[model samples]
Target: MEDIMRGRFSRSMITVAVAAAAVSAVLSVSITRTLGQAPAARPARVGGKPNFSGIWQANNEANWDLQAHAALPAAVTQPGIYPYDYARVPAAPVLALGAAGAVPGSLGVVQGDGQIPYKPEALLIKKQNAEHWIDRDPELKCYLPGIPRAMYMPYPFQITQGTDKIHIAYEFSNTARTIHLDKVAGPPDDTWMGHSVGRWDGDTLVVDVLICATHNLLKLFRFGWSPQRA
Candidate 1:
């Protein structure tokens, strides 16, 4: 690429991040610090098992690894192995930068939604990700939605436990997992969430998983691939 074109693209990224930040600030202020009310505790059933239900949040940075903070990088480039045409990646045209400016890139940028501030190398990898996110994002292809990916999906899921079974329902694609609480005790087979084993210890719910790969189903099924296809 010519020096002039590189400058234009870099500037464009800055502008995009700035504008997104302003709008995000407004949206955050509207939320109350905490829920206004809490439910009263209920007594345990005959078996002394407690019911686990109600709104809960899983707090983790896994969702925003790429958008941890708003900061300019030493360099931002696309990943090498991902599919899709790099030139086709989406980037808004250039504009001004402000402390309140929206961080450039995609998905997580707003005011507080600034750049993900990935480690230097990770940022470069994700920068490559930015280039083809529309097509290459595994979630879009119906893949497993990977760790942290599945956790942060826009939809809500529920977990229900019974004496013999435990059920988890995912909002995306209506994906669900059913665990045999009775311990069928059989040889392992591969599945999306792999096989889950669950038990309760006082107030905590324990989940054990294995043999899972990929967040989207389409990709994990493939054992081999063409070089060009990648």
Candidate 2:
């Protein structure tokens, strides 16, 4: 019985020693692991200002047709590619060509029933404009697509922001907008891009735009920014 007790104690001591050795090895490995520098630093405010520096873009069909719409025929169509060979052609050439550039149906992003509010006369003008959009659209004329329109255009834009100024460079028409943070004054001129003044409300940037060329063009826009890095 004495020999048996001694054997049991020895075995317990051996098991405890093995467990201790395993724990020590694990801790040693954890300590020796190489933790390289993080790939990117978290976004931080400089001089107590929001950092809006980034490439941003809108993903929607707003650029094509602003209102909610069903699939529509393409703007332009040409004769069949196989002009002489009528037998090989499946159907009308316009139908085949139109299928490629047809605008996909969208529920639309516009607020309130996805329709713009216009007076009777203005609505009539808009309908006429829509009929002649190919020729009358401001975008086709290489005009600076104005606000709200510029924000959601189907192109990416880069924003470089500072405490005193914010610069937005758009991919379309190489257009851009400058938002002054300090100066308060009347618009120096009436232009497509317009004049902007900006202020911060928490992390949200509020910009007041004035386009003197058009009536009642004072628009206030807000852009909220978060510091979480992706």
lDDT of 1 by residue, 8-110 (tens): 9999998988878866776665444344446566435424566654333444333333344333221222334556444322233211222222223334423
lDDT tens per residue, model 2, 60-95: 877655677665555332335655432222234334
TM-score of each: 0.44, 0.59
Segments of candidate 1 deviating more than 4 angstroms: 1-46, 54-62, 71-132, 146-148, 185-188, 214-230
Worst 10 residues of 1 by lDDT: 221-230
Candidate number achieving the greatest lDDT relative to the actual structure: 2
- Candidate 2, residue 190: the lDDT equals 69
